[model samples]
Target: MDITSPSFKENATRAIGDKSLQKALGNVERGFIYKRAKAVAAVPAFETLRDAARDIKNHTLAHLDLYLEAYADKVAATGGHVHFAETAADARDIVLDICRRVEAKTVTKGKSMITEEIALNDHLEKNGITTVETDLGEYIIQLRGEHPSHIIAPAVHLNKEQIEADFRRVHDKLPPERNLDEPVALLGEARAVLRERFLAADVGITGANFLVAETGTSIIVTNEGNGDLTQILPRVHIVVASIEKVVPTLEDASAILRVLARSATGQEMSVYTTLSTGAKRSGDPDGPDEYHVVLLDNGRSAMLGTPFEDMLRCIRCGACMNHCPVYQVVGGHAYGWVYPGPMGSVLTPTLIGVDKAGHLPNASTFCGRCESVCPMRIPLPKMMRHWRENAFARHLTPPSERSGLGVWKFLARRPALYALATGIAVRAMALLKPKGGRFRTLPFASGWTRHRDLPAPEGRTFQAMWKDRKAGK
Candidate 1:
């Protein structure tokens, strides 16, 4: 889609005011948070698994070049083509070229964020190749002409009612009197429609959750069986993935997979964890005849030796986003990019530049919930802080925010002055407090008081309270 990260503030304002969106956002907390907590609680070694996952990713990243070479060699040995794409444009061109060589008229796709990152669908459509999204959520959003709001749950921002409306509008060929009030009905309708597309497709495209270097396997984990059909029922199967997605071995991938589903959808294991090595074997009953992998760098290799390199460890499990308060409130659309939440805050800035996506890093409250729950233990808040510093250094941050930080920095350097100023300001605010011990508006903090009242400071600074406690007074 378009880079809307620049308009994040405007998008967040509109999202907060949208009642329908607020209602849909409620599902995020209710559906994901509790389920993840329960799933994690059930696994006694979950924390240990998280550490293993992080170490696996770190090791793979360190030897990424070697692993990638090994992976390409393995794919070649199995009669598969491996194309390395240095840019998003290159990735798209490679896929298009493959499709043209195959004389592909229609393509079916599994849910793939890399495809979204490269804007593959738009490019293919523009080239007269009809592309269809086979995943249910993807199909719904495709009909609505929208990008995924959440990484794993694309239609999480939408409700069943809205989906019913879209289904009715787009599937006008279906019976007008047909029932689609239930989610099952919606699934059945989508399945029926996508089944046709699957059979008719000349090529099927998928995103890899992990690419195994040892076996040259491209693996995808999905709750629905759509991924299997999308990859198997077509003449050509194309895998599009970022370079960082490659793991050194299948064992490393399995270890990482241990935490992926729990952190993502709270399942012990996803219903379908399919591994494709290459094209169909001689005795294979059903498989693609042609297999290809397009490995897109897209600025990832640039992050390798940088502070943001830790972000590459992301499994796309989305635990960070699920627990991010900012994302929970505003939803993914507010971030205005292909990715959203804490991971997006750091990654978006690197891929698109802090100049365009500066607001995303500043969007966090720095509560650190994202880091706490991340399967790979990515320090999301720290990465966001890095982006913030990058933005400020590049003069991309707004002047008002820069001045505010400048004022804070001056006071921060002098402890006594900072304490005295905070003490005086706290007492003054306490004296000015209304009957309910809250301020409906503040002189320089109108943004804070706009949506909710600010509580009075209780006539003392945190330092004073701590001093008193230390003295046992």
Candidate 2:
């Protein structure tokens, strides 16, 4: 809930030293990536679906105002209240107002990044309301008093052993001798604990994966059915989501849904894909008595028709983060914000201001993996480059980095000088090599050399080798 983004460098360094965190991060690659590849392979038209999804989002974002108006009308028509929040503070207040109206003592919630972005739980608790997380991964992090490290898998930074310990420590009423060695046992304990909270809570809250204009419906895709219970079992249901989540029609939403699960968790479909239009109707057997939707802009409106407009197409499936090498090493917590990874790198600066979150865009290796994996085909690396240039233009970049780039730019403009400078630098590096042809320490390169040796320049530069090959007469 705290904005530690300014201390991202320190957070990353600390995360590197945590063995448990490293071990937990390993599962991300070995599990999600591999499964997603297999899932994509099985679907022959997966690529086509991706392009279709991207187009749908592009079209929707271009006419976002129209769709949002239509969505609001549909919600009103269904007897649901639609609240527009221009900022995070506005969103928090709207939720707080609803809670106060109901005299809510406790609120049960499904996983929602929008809620995290607004710091909803902290604000509610500060106002004397108790918020209980119903999702298993969310419940674990809630018990540990930590923010989500991963978007979909909130507790991905934790392992089974850590979870066992958290449960034992938090669920004080449980028998001390109970076996929580297995994942099933751990899940069962959390389920039992959350079930009681769900039954007793006065209000329910959730995040929407998609909002349909034609139906005024909020959609949630989850492996666990906790979201359903979070919404249906309570007296009042509230949906907290960003403005970008709205889609024009049910057909467009269906197209996006086709790729959402495969891109996020490598499944054909999530176990639970629930859609709700509004509160219980006259004929409805069982449902909530009240329905409300909080739509937060939080700086998204300023991005339209700008260079960052493409970022508005994000579906929040989290494929970009899942495939990012930078995210893989440091983990999401290092980004030090509600959103982390490639999408976060671009979006956080937009929402929270570039000065505070500039390090996020700079953290990428720009390998293009995020773009390739994204179902929406968002140019994540290009957007990050835009941020880098913005930072440089504003003089927000450190003096050393700015000077280095300035020198490089000066040399790059001259072809002959650039080649000569690189040739001489390569020869000098070769001469400085000791014994194993590696440099353990180098001035201005301690950041890299501290962790791994820099391989010595073997001979001439690649340009020289290419020139020799081309001139082989």
What are the clash counts of all predictions, listed in order? 0, 0
Task: For candidate 1, write residues 1-473 as lDDT tens digits.
Answer: 88999999999999999999999999987789999999999999999999999999999999999999999999999999999999999999999999999999999999999999999999999999999998888999999999999999999999999999999999999999999989999998988988899999999999999999999999999988888999999999999999999998889989999999999989989999999999999999999999999999999999999999999999998888889889998999999999999999999988888889999999999999999999999998998999888888988877888899999999999999999999899999999989988899998888878889988988999999999999999
**Candidate 1's error at 346, in angstroms?**
1.2
lDDT of 2 by residue, 1-473 (tens): 77888898999899989898989999998778988898889999999999999998888888899999999999999999999999999999999999999999999999999999999999999999999998899999999999999899999999999999999999999899999999999999988888899999999999999999999999998888999999999999999999999998889988998899988999988899999998999998889999999999999989998889999888888889889988888899999999999999999999888999999998898999999999899999999999999988999999988888899999999989999999999999998888888889999978778889988998699988989999993
Q: Global CA lDDT of candidate 1, please? A: 0.94
> How well does candidate 1 score on lDDT at residue 185?
94
Which candidate leads in lDDT? Answer: 1
Task: After superposing candidate 2 on the true structure, give the runs of residues whose Cα lies further than 4 Å from its correct spot.
Answer: none
- Model 1 alpha-carbon drift over 4 Å, by segment: 464-473
* Number of residue pairs clashing in candidate 1, backbone atoms closer than 3 angstroms, sequence gap of 3 or more or interchain: 0
TM-score of each: 0.96, 0.96
lDDT agreement with native, every candidate: 0.94, 0.92
